[model samples]
Target: GSITHILIFASGASKVPLAGFQGTPTITFLEPGLGQSLPTANTCSVSLNLPMCSTFNDFSEGMALAIACAKTFGIA
Candidate 1:
């Protein structure tokens, strides 16, 4: 029903966060802005990346995350 947690990726950025972050990250679920460009989830395989983002929003990140989760969980 919500993102239990997540790690966002930018182009040319590190894929993994630092070893341990015990605190839950405070994040904002921004709605799609006016014709904003969304990048493909290149941080990992689509299957491994998208589902982590789907439920909270309906933007490009959500699409990418859903694809990744479906791939990993086999629930397309």
Candidate 2:
């Protein structure tokens, strides 16, 4: 099976920001409404590498983003 999304949470700072990273495939399409429904087909895969998120509040924020993404993709 192919990967649909990749969300990475790192404790240290990344040399390159997530928006500037060029290693991952482009996510050409995203589900509308932010957190509404599932897509009928796999449009593209997305990768998000968030760094320096070691604190409790940072972790919470990361989890929140994860949950929001999951809900947006209808996976949660």
Candidate 3:
């Protein structure tokens, strides 16, 4: 038998004074698309610490990024 699990972490602030995002490995690779809205306010900092057991390649990473973004920010 085999068991697997994936963990995704996302955090952000609302109404921040200044600054955008620090950019993580997944974020750097995904490169947030235009028109994408984050959960936090315009002036806020959001973060996601996603974890995947397998399929951690570009494709999976992209999918994970999208899922995380949408789930956190309610994107589509």
| Candidate 2 Cα outliers beyond 4 Å, as residue runs | 1-53, 74-76
Candidate 3 TM-score, true structure as reference: 0.23
lDDT of 3 at 18: 61
Cα lDDT tens digits, model 1, 11-70, are: 222244465333332333334443433323343331122223344455555555544553
Model 1 ranges off by over 4 Å: 1-24, 36-76
CA deviation > 4 Å runs, candidate 3: 1-44, 57-65, 68-76
Candidate 2: residue 50 lDDT (0-100) = 33
Candidate maximizing TM-score: 2
Candidate 2: Cα lDDT at 42: 29
Predicted candidate 3, C-alpha RMSD: 14.1
lDDT of 2 by residue, 1-76 (tens): 1122232321112244656544453333333435423222222333332333336585456545554455345335
| Predictions: Cα RMSD each | 9.6, 12.0, 14.1
Each prediction's whole-model lDDT (CA)? 0.37, 0.37, 0.35
lDDT of 3 by residue, 1-76 (tens): 0011122233323333266346532322223444332222221234343333234474455544454554445335
